[model samples]
Target: MSASGAKTNLHEFVVQENEQVAEGLWRMRCNTALAAELAPGQFVQVSVPADASHILRIPLSFARADARSGELDIVYAVVGEGTRRLSAMAVGQASTMVGPCGNGWWLPQDQGRALLVAGGVGLPPIFACASMLAQTGVGFDVVVGAQTASRHCVGYVDELRSMGIHEGCDCARKVVLTTDDGTLGMRGFVTQAMENLLAEHTYAQVYACGPNPMMAGVAKLSMSKDIACEVSLERMMGCGFGACSCCNVALVDGTQALCCTDGPVFDARRVQWQTR
Candidate 1:
C-alpha cells in the first residue's frame, strides 16, 4: 500500500505443470522465490518471452504459494493471444515474470461465518483464502461453479482440515458445487448456489472472484443480504509495476484507482460494477 515505487519484483520462473484442468481453464505451476510474497487474490505479470511473435506479458492471479518449496500456482483461462502462448509452454522451460502484485483480501476476526463464491478461473485465489479463514478459527462455506466437473478438486477442504477447522460434517458440506452441464453437483450458476446459502445463513461477509458478470451477480447478492463483500479484479496491463497507466480503474465513487498498484482486490461496493 506504499505510494509510488515499482511493487513488481522481477524473476525467472520455470514451468512445472501446465495442464488443462477443464474446458478452458489451465492450472499452471511455476518455480520462483516470489512464492514467499504472494498471497491469495494477488497476481503475477508474466512476459511471454521477447520476440516478434509475442512481446506482451499477461497478468495472472495467484491462487496459492508454497513458501517452503518456492513454488507458485496459478489458474488462468485462455482468453487472448498471450494466454494461448502461455498455455502451450512446455515443462522445464522458463518464463519471465514480475510480481506478487496487487492488494489481497482482508479477513476480519469479528466477521462470523464466511461465504465464498467463485466462478471458473477465479476459484484459484480463494484456495489460499480458505487457509486464512481457518487461521481465524471461523467456520466458512466455499462454493465454486464451472461449466463442467473435469476441473473439480476439493483441495480447499483438505487445507481447512489441515488448519484445524473442526466443523466436521457441516464444513464438508460447505463446499457446494455446480456445473452448467450438470456434470458434478448443482446444475446452475454460482449465483444460484450463493443465493441458497444466503437464504440459509446470514453471512458475515462475502468474497468472490470470476468474470465481471458473475462478480456483478455476487455484488447484488451481497447488497441484498447486507453483507460486506470484496472482489479480486482483473484488468489489461502494459506494466504490472504501476509505471504504465494502462491499468487504471474508476471505482463507483468516481475515484480513479490503479488496478495493479491500488488493488486487484476491492470491496464490492467500491467497484464501478454496473457499467463494466
Candidate 2:
C-alpha cells in the first residue's frame, strides 16, 4: 500500500451530498480532485468546521471514489463531537481534507478467491477493496457484522448498491451479513460467519477491518489456517500525515508504529494483538 497518485495536501472540498443511512451513521459525498488520487484501504483526515473545540481532524476511509466524478464517499458512525459535526454538514458546505495517506492493503497478484471481513464502521476500506477486486475479476466473499440488524442499514446497503452489488448482483451470494440479535442474515458476529466460509471455501487471502477485538479474532483465525492476511487498523488520528504521533500502534517487534504512516493496514501476522 505504498502512497501513490498526486501530491498529498490540504484540499478544499465541498460536500456534494450528505444523508443519514441509520442511527448516528452518515454517508457523505464530497467533490475533490484528491478522490482520484486515493487508493483502496487509505484514509482522509477531515476537519469538521462545526467542531471548533476539537482541533484534531477525523480520519475516515474511502467507501467509494469516482475519479471521473471527483466524488469521494465517506461512511462513518458518529461516536463523538467531531463526527457529529461532520454528519451535520449540508450539501455545498466546504471542509479541509488531507490524505490518500497510510500504507493500504497488499493486493495479491494471484487474484484468486479471497475473504473480506468487516465489522461496524470498518466497512469502508474493505468495501473499497471489494470494488477493485470485482473489477479485476478476483473471486471474493464478504462477511460483515454489526451490533443489530438496524445497525446493518448504516450505509452497508447503499455502499453495496453503489458498487453495483445487490440481491441479484453477481456477487450477491458471496456477501453475508450478521447481527448480534438475530435481526439480520445470520445471528452472530462476523467471525462466526467467517468460520463457516472458511470451512467451505479455500481462500487465497484474507482482508479485514473493524474493532480491535473483531480484527484480532480474524487475524488469529487467518494465522491458524496459515492464510495470508492483511488488516486495516483504526486509531484516533490528529494529523493525516506522519507528523502526528497520535495514531501509533504497537507492533509484533515491540516497536511503535504509526497507523497514519507505517500503516492503517498491515500484515495480520505483524500486529501485536496483546497490546491492542
Candidate 3:
C-alpha cells in the first residue's frame, strides 16, 4: 500500500474515446483495469505516448470510474503542452498510467445534507464526489462555476440532477451554475451562489475543488459556518508518488504535506489559505 492507503499500480490503457466537451476542455474515456481501483478524489499519472522529451506523466483526476465496464472517464483542460498532447491522442491509442494515487473524499460524519463546490475543470472530481454521495444515499446540493458558458460541463450538471432523484431523499436537491462572464446561469463566482445556498440550508459537510483563491474562499465560508469541509487541491507534481517534494501543501500547523502521497483531498481547516 502507498502512503495514501490505496494500492498503486502501473497499468496499460487503451483510449476508447477522446473528444472536446467544452471550450478548452476535453473528456477522455479509456479502458483499463485501474478503473476498478480508483475512488473519488484520487488521481492518476498518465504517460503521454510518443513524447519522450516530455517525460513527466500528466497527473489527472477522473470524473467517473466503472468497475463493471472497466472504463474510466477523465475530463481535463488544455492548459499546457502536456494536456494539449493528451487531447490529440487518437482513439485506440495505448498508454501507461500509474494510479489509485492519493486519498479520496470521506462521507459526511453527521449524516445531514452535504454541499459540493467545483470551479472550472475541478468539476471532474466533484462529479466523482457526487457519485459517491449518491451511491451512499446522502443528500447533496452542488454549485459549479466556470469562466463562461462555453467552459461549463453541462453534462456533469445533468448527471448531478439525475442523482438527486434518489428514493432516499425527501427535500429537493439544488444544482446551481455560475459563470464569471455572465454568459450562462448565475452571473457571478460560485462563492456567490454558495452563499445563498448556505443561507437557505443547514449542511453537515462541504466538499470543494478549484483554483487556490477560489478554494480559499470556500474554506473560509465553511469554517465560519462550523461545518466540516474537505477540499481536493491541485499541484504540480514531479513524481506521482512521494519520491519528489514538488507538490507540497502548506498547513495551518506550520507543516507541509505532500499532495501526491498525503492528499489531493484534505480537511479544509487544516490548509493555510493564501489570499490574492
Candidate 4:
C-alpha cells in the first residue's frame, strides 16, 4: 500500500457529538458520506489541532462506522494537547483525516471459534471488527477489560442497557468485562478473564487491540496454547496517512512496518513490543 493522501470528501468527517462514554473515554461520531465503506479492524487517522499550544495530528482508531447513516465513531481518551483540542471542538466542525488505513482485523475463513479481545481504549478497533464479523454469519466471542466498569466503551452492555449497535448476534455469545479496581464487572485484570476463557474453550483464532502489556500478555498465552492471534498497535502520529513516517515500528522479522501502511493490525507473534 502507498501513503494515504488527503482527498476531498475522503471520509473526512464532521464531529456530530463527542460524549463521555467513560471517565476519560470520549465517543466521537463523525458525520461522513462514506461511513458505509469502512469495515471492521480498519482505522482512520484524524488530524487534531492542538490547543493554541502546538500543532500535531492525533491518530485514532475507528470504533464503529455506520455507512447507512453516514456516521463514523471513534472512542478515545484525553492524553495530550491534540485530544484536548478535539474534545473542545464544537459539533459541526470537521476533522481532516485519512483512512481505513493499515490492515483490518478480520477473522480467518475457517476460524472455528474466534475470540476478539479488547482493553481500555483498544476496544474501539474491536468494535469495528465485531460489526464485520456479525455480517459474515460467523460466531465469535468478545472480551473487554478496563480499570473499572465505567471505563468500558459505549457498545458494551452495562446490565440494563446495550451500548453497541447489534444486540443479538447469532448463538456465538460473549463473556467479558474485567476491572482492576472492582468498581464494576469482574474485579481483576483482563488477562485473567482471557485465561479463564481460553481454559474453558479452545479458540481457533484470537484477535486483540490494546496497550502493550495487555497485547503482549495475550500473545504469550496464545503462543503457549498454539492459538493464532493478531494485534492492532497504537502509536503517536503526525499524519494519519503514511507520509509522515511517524507511526513506523520495526517488526520482529527485522522488517519495517508503518502503522499507517503495513498495519495497525499485525499477527501477535510478529510484533516487537518495546517503548521507544
lDDT of 3 by residue, 194-248 (tens): 9999998999999999998899999999999999999999999999898889999
- Top candidate on lDDT is 3
> After superposition on all CA atoms, what RMSD does each candidate show versus the true structure?
3.0, 2.6, 1.3, 3.5
lDDT of each: 0.78, 0.83, 0.92, 0.73
Ranking according to lDDT, highest score first: 3, 2, 1, 4
Candidate 3 positional error at 167, Å: 6.4
lDDT for model 4 comes to 0.73
- Give the alpha carbon lDDT tens digit for every residue of 122-186 in model 1: 88777778767766666788888888887665554345335544545344437788888899889
lDDT of 4 by residue, 123-205 (tens): 87877676666666556777888887677764544311232326564454765778889877788877888888888887888
Off by over 4 Å in 1: 1-7, 151-173
TM-score of candidate 4 on Cα atoms, chains taken together: 0.86
- The worst-scoring run of ten residues by lDDT in candidate 2 lies at 157-166
Question: In model 4, which regions exceed 4 Å deviation?
Answer: 1-11, 49-53, 158-172, 274-276
Residue 96 of model 2 has an lDDT of 89
Ranking, TM-score, top scorer first? 3, 2, 1, 4
